[model samples]
Target: MKLKSFLLICFSMFFVVSTVQAATTISISVNGTTVKTDVAPFIENGTTYVPLRSVEQIEGLSIKSWNNKTKTLIISDPSKSMTFRVNNQSQSDSPLIKNNRVMVPIRFIARNFSSDVAWNAYTKTVHVAKINDKEKANLKSEDITESRIAAINIPIISTLKELTAGESSAGYFQLMFPEGESKNFFTIQNGIINHYQVKENAAWLTWSGIIGGNKNTNTFWVTNTDISSEVGQRPTSKDRLFFYNISEHSGQSQHGYISTNGEKTILGSKDMNSLNDLYPIPEEELKH
Candidate 1:
């Protein structure tokens, strides 16, 4: 009986240590290549903690929540966003920041957007990898355009129309790049314009715009599906035209809205995809 009790205690202790004090970023390997970041990640306590961002960025993905009702965080590249539960729940109050460190939920922080997570207790580490090719392909082909990080000659009018239509009125234009490319999208807004989704690798001559007599000017990277950090200060003609940005990983995008009103409110969040079908991609644009 004593031996059995000892084993139970040991097992319990291991679980606690493996999932405590939130996720911290540490060195990790992506596709057999090692990368590093300052983002906190999941580790075996004493073992090095690998940052999920490093893996996600290296893997060309991002992370977001499955829904508001659940505590799961969905890591996704352009191709897909897989769900994972954080062992611990986060508080509504903003995260505590000590010194230069910003604290976040462990489980949420450990998972990257658009990747699969496997926790190995024996090895005392968490493994992140691209989901199976079948799943990845399916996710990529579902919506939007695949975005490769490349310099795109985006015309101001084209970007303005796409942005105002997609974002200003609680809408978004789905985008993607070719497979196996890393890029970001950026935009500049002036007056009344709230935000823009610019591909990281895309280069435009002018991003500043005038909306309702307000001048909004800002640059951003649009290469991640989840842009939670960019949502704030609703841009209006009266109040500074806040320049919120959007981005996504490279893969099959659902080709729909990911946020509304400067907040990262994706299409799936408000059941927009379920209610009304996504807008049809125009025949001219569907040539791809």
Candidate 2:
């Protein structure tokens, strides 16, 4: 009886350990910048799973549609397309919807998009990097210079007003920084700010935080200060409107004022236009 009881205890411990490993939270980074997601990624049976919406942020990948009746999901890019069935019990690698978020295999999706995916066991993190074909060809040439590489990495600066001038008015705008290769895309809808970062030739949704408004004044404050590391710290008050400009709907320096905060304040600016534009976000992204 003593030996049997010891065996049972050992089995129970093994089961608990396995369960913990399966549910381990995983951090995802694209090109090096860590991305924030509404539903955290996790590992199960040695496969890392991320939110399906997160996959849409990757360059050259788009979620076309998902049919509930058939449980079929269609994802495509300019060059290739793929389909998957959700919660297919017969398929171990099938995508699953949990807590209203569609979770898909990261490796499978990454490979389909021609992006390199790496896993770090120590940190429990997944890194996805998009391969630039032009960069590879340029590297092989002897004419490549340090100055040219620097110029290639430089991000184009543009204001929201300019980018969305001809399009239908929405509470969305693209903001670019002149300081670094980081381009920030934002949508100020309702009272929330959905922030996205463009890096490694792909876009990642970095933050979705609340914006505080003052009823007495025309100014509003961004509640979350730690939005982007590349842009550095920004003041919460109206001291400087980093990417928003109220007067002309143009991009402003750190010394600009915030005249409009809610809905009407989707401001942006442009400088030294480059092809490395901000990745487009889905129209229904915030709706979910």
Location of the lowest summed lDDT over 10 successive residues in candidate 1: 149-158
The residue pairs in collision within model 2 are: 157-270, 157-271, 158-269, 158-270, 159-268, 159-269, 159-270, 160-268
User: What's the true lDDT of residue 14 in model 1?
Assistant: 28
lDDT of each: 0.30, 0.46
TM match of model 2 to true structure:
0.42
lDDT, residue 151, candidate 1: 19
Alpha carbon lDDT at 278, candidate 2: 20
After superposition, candidate 1 runs with Cα above 4 Å error: 1-27, 38-55, 62-76, 79-98, 103-114, 131-288
Runs in model 2 with CA error above 4 Å? 1-24, 88-92, 142-288
Q: Write the per-residue lDDT of candidate 2 for residues 28-121, one digit (tens) a residue.
A: 7665545678888877677788888887666667899999888789899888788899873423468987677778988888876887666655
RMSD (Å) of each candidate, 1 decimal: 20.1, 19.6
RMSD of 1: 20.1
